[model samples]
Target: MLLQSPWPSRVNDSSTKATHVFITDFLKEKGVSTLDVLVNNAAIGSECFKETFDVNVVGTVAVTWANVNRVLR
Candidate 1:
């Protein structure tokens, strides 16, 4: 199934735990126990500054933190 899908698949909400769980399962399914690198590049320049900051700053931090602990040494 994954082989049929396109590369560079995206996870919409990085801050969501469900997304993290999905990622954990997906990686496991692919026989990956840990991540090698995590790139937090979720940036946006929306009209609402707070919203932009939440997604770009908080969300990125949240995602990176969640994945860092799981990455391979």
Candidate 2:
């Protein structure tokens, strides 16, 4: 099944623990037991280094870790 869930686009919002929980809950609510692949493509090319790091680096790690158990090995 192809589940297309909405992720937070904003830098601050994307990396939060709440966002990760929400995403996981969303998948569970939709009956997604396991995911074949997770395409974490959230990024930002802003002048602010913190914003860029938050979205590109922190956000990616947070989301991946949050859903790691759901991914098919």
What does each candidate score in C-alpha RMSD?
12.4, 13.1
Tens-digit per-residue lDDT, 1-73, candidate 1: 4345754445667469877876797788889888887654455233565776688889999998889967746
Best by TM-score: 1
- The residue-by-residue lDDT of candidate 2 on 1-73, one tens digit each, is 2245353333335568876766677578778776676544455334565677688889999999999989856
Sequence-dependent TM-score of model 2: 0.33
Off by over 4 Å in 2: 1-47
Query: Where does candidate 2 have its weakest 10-residue lDDT segment?
Result: 1-10
Error of 2 at 68 (Å): 0.4
What C-alpha lDDT do the candidate models reach, one value each? 0.70, 0.64
**Which segments of model 1 are wrong by more than 4 Å?**
40-73
Report lDDT (Cα) of residue 62, candidate 2: 98
Instruction: Rate residue 61 of model 1 by lDDT.
Output: 94
